[model samples]
Target: MRKYSIIFIFIAFVCHFVTGQNKQLLYDFSEIPQSLLINPGTETDFQWYSGVPILSGISLQAGSSGISVNDLFANDGIDFNDKVRDRLINGMSPKDDLSGTYQIELINIGYRGAETDNFYSFGIYNEGDAIGYWFKDYAKLGFEGNADNLNNRFNLSHLKTRGEILNVFHFGVTKEIDNKLTFGVRGKLYSGIIDFTSTKNKGYFVTTEGQNNLLSNTLSADLELKSSGIITLDHVIDGDSSAGDMIKRGFFGGDLGLGVDLGFTYHLNEQTLITGSLLDLGFLYHSTDVLSYTLKGNATVEGVEIILPDAINDPNTDFWQDLVDDVEGLVPFEENRKSYITFRPTKLYGSLRYNFGETVQSKGRLDCDCNLSGGKSNRTKYANGVGGQLYVINRPRGPQAALSAFYQRRFGNIMAVKTTYTIDKYSFSNVGLGLNLQAGPINMYFMADNLLAYRNIAASNYASFQLGINIISWGKN
Candidate 1:
C-alpha cells in the first residue's frame, strides 16, 4: 500500500511538471534585461543596467501534453484503481514526458562601452534542467502482473531520463555594425554540480506458453545509468561536510565546459525587423565523482516438470531458487566508476516584428538620439509593436517547438506591457502576459503563462512564472 502511494505521488508530479522550455512572453521584450539572456542582439535603448542580485532574474516553467491532476486525484468520485488503469496505464504513451527548467541569476550587469559605443554585459547564474519520458508498458506490467498478461512484450526501452544542476558564467557584447544589422555573441563557461542520466535503453520482457511447463518467461535487457558529483553532495546533505564544500564543487570548481550564444537583429526597413538566436552550443565532461551502472543480456526460464508421482515425493525441490540463479547468470548487472560527456541542450529562437505608432521619447533624451551609440540608428521607439516568434529546444527524444504571436504597448520608459497567444504541444490557448515598470532608477518586471490555469494550478496542464528587479541609468544626459 505504501509503495502504491509513492507511485501515485510520482504520477502526480510528472503530470504537473512535464513541459517544454519556452519563454515567449519575455523573449524579445527589450524593456526587461533578462530578455538579453535569450537574444543578446535584442535592440536596447538603455544606457546601463544592473540586476538586484538573486531577485533580478528568477524563472520556473512546468507543463505537460498529457493528463492533468484532475484526471486521477480530482473529486470525481471514481475508484482510484480505475482511474490509474484508464488514465495512465491505458491513456498515456511512451512519448509523453515529464520535464521542467529553472534559472536564477546571481549577478547581472550591463553597461555601454564609452570607448566603443558597444554594449558589454556579464553575469553568473545557476540553472537546472530535467526531463523523463513516460514508460507505459512498464507501468502497465507493474500494475497488473504478467499472470494475467501472457505473450505480451513489455518494453524496457521506455525508461528515459536526464537531469542536471550547474552554474554558468557568461560575458557578452552587442555591437551595431551598421544601421540595418546589429549582432551580438555571448561566451559561457559551465560548471556542473550534480547530474544523472539514463536515456539509451533496449530490450523487453515476455511470458509465453511452454511445452514442458505451464509457462515460459523471457527477459532481454540493455540499460545504463550515469551520474557525477551526487556522492559527495549526499554526504554534505547528511551533515558530514560543510555547505562550502559543495559550493566549491560549483562555480568553476567542478566539471567544466564551454559554450556560446549568437544572435542578430536585422532591420528590413525602419519599422519591420527580423531576429534570431542560437544558444548553449557546448558540452560537459564528467570525470570527478563519477559512477555508472549497466545491465545487459537475455534470459529464459520455465518451471520444473512436475511428474504427478515424482512431485509428491520431492516437495522440497527449490524450483524458484534455481530459476532465480539461472536468470542472474544469463543477465548480468554491473556498476563501474567510468566518466562520460554530456552535450548541452541547445536552443533556437527567431522572430519577426513590426513597429507602429509615433515615436515616444521620455525623460533625458537628445533631440536626435544618435549620440547614444556613435551613429546608433536614430530609429524611433514606437508606442506599439506586434510580432511572431518561434522557439525550439533539443531534448533526449527530439526537438520540441512552440510558436507565439504577441502584441506590445509601451508608455515611454515608464511602463511596458506585452501579451501573447502561443500554440505548442502542451496547450493551444496558452495566454502569456508580462509587465515592466521603471520608477526613477529602479526597474522591475513580471511575466507568466497559462493564465487560464492560474485559477486552478493543480488542474493545469502547463504553467510558468518569471519576475525580476533591477536598477538602470540612461547615462548623464
Candidate 2:
C-alpha cells in the first residue's frame, strides 16, 4: 500500500497543465485590433473601433508533442502496453513536453484618444493555459517496477507543472513619439477561475539490501501541491451549486492579480523597420478557497517486523494492519488551507521587416500605419514586404522559441494578406495565414495556423485559428 503513493502524484500532475497552443499567426499581424493583445504598442489607423460583442474575437488552439492519441490506442494490432513502453523509453526524453492554450474575448473595443498621437484600447477575455514536461523516471517505474530494476535511483525531481484558467480585464495606451518610434503599455487585472501549480519537488525511491527480508525499500519525499478554486467545487454540480456560481466567482469573487505588457516599434529607415514586446509580468495571489497538500518525510521499510504468537493463520489476525499503521506513523502527510502566489507565464516577441515594390503615400500621421512604423514620406504603403519574426514563451520545461519568415501583400488600402512559415518544438511544417479587409467603416479579419495538418488533424501535433469583426471610424485631419 505504501508503494501506491506514486499513483496519486502521477494522477495529480497529469490531469492538468497540458501545454498551450502557439499563437504565431496573430502575434504581429497589426492589421487587426487583436494584435494589440500581444503587443500593446502596435499602431492603428482607425479613429475608433468597437468589436461585435462576443463575436468580436474568438480563438482556439490545441497541441501535444512526443506522442498522440493514435500512437497508443490505435486498432493496428500492436500491444497497447508494449507500444507505450517503447515510446516512453525510445520515442521521448525528459525535455519533450505537451502544452496549449484556449482564449475567447468577452468584450473588446479601441479608439484614438483625445491626444492627437495617442490610442486607447480595452477588453475582457477568458483564457486557459498549461505546461508540463515528460516524467521519464516515473514512466519507467510504472512500466518496469522495482522488482526487476534493483539499486536504480528513481528520481522525483522530474515532476514540474503549472496551469490556470482565468478572466483578464485589460486597458492599454499606445503613444507615438515623433514619427519614427511608437511605444505602448498595458495593465491587466486577472480573476482566477481555477489554478494549480507544483514546483521544487525533491526526493528519490530505491531498493537496497535488507537484514531479514530479501530486499528493503527506502523513500525520501519533500513535495507540495498548491491549488485554488478546485477543492471548494467538490459539490459544484449538485443542488443549487451550478456552473453559474463558479462563473460569478471567476468574474469578481475569485483570487485576483495584476500584470503588465510593454512594447515598441521603431523605423530604422524609410524601408526598414523593427518591433518588440514583453508580456505578462505579474503574479496571482490565491487566497480564496486555497488548499495545499504537503509530504515531507523519509522512511525505510523491511517487511512486517511483528509476528502473531498464536492464531497467526487466522483470517481475523491483525498483524498486517499493525504493520500498515507503523508505516503511516513514520511518514506523515498533511493538508492546509493556506494562500500562495503563482506567476504568469511570460512571453517575448520581436521582428524585423523591409519594404519593397510600389509604395503608397499617406495624407497625414493618422494614415501612416505600417509595420514597425515604416511607410512612405507622409505614409508609405508598399505592394510587398518581407520580414522575420522571433518568439519565446517561458514554460515549465524552460523557454521554447520559434522562428518565422513572412511575406505580406497589399491590394490598395482596402485589402491585405500575410503568410508565415514557422519552426517550433511542436512541428516544422507550421504554416500560418492572416487576411484583413476593410469595407468603408467596417473591418474584418481571419487567421489560421498549421495548414499542413488540416488534412489529417489527428496525426498533427499542432493547430490554431482566430477571426473577428469590428466597426471603425477613420479621422480626416
Best by lDDT: 1
lDDT of 2: 0.77
Looking at model 1, the pairs that clash are 18-63, 18-99
For model 1, the local distance difference test gives 0.83
Using all chains and alpha carbons, the TM-scores for the candidates as numbered come to 0.91, 0.88
lDDT by residue (tens digit), candidate 1, 1-477? 564455335434533352336889888898788888898897676688999999999998886666778788998899999998998888888888767878889999998887544788899998878787888888988899799889999999998888777899999998877777889899999999877788899999999998678799889999998988767666665668778876886776778888999999988877888999999989889888887899899988786555678778888877778677777888988889888999898999999999888676744322254422335555567789999999999988899899999999998879999999999877898999999999999999999999987787777778888999999887774
lDDT scores in order: 0.83, 0.77
Shift in Å, residue 168, candidate 1 = 0.7
Task: Give the Cα-based TM-score of candidate 2 against the true structure.
Answer: 0.88
Tell how far residue 384 is off in model 2, in angstroms.
2.1
Alpha-carbon runs more than 4 Å astray in model 1: 1-20, 304-325, 362-375
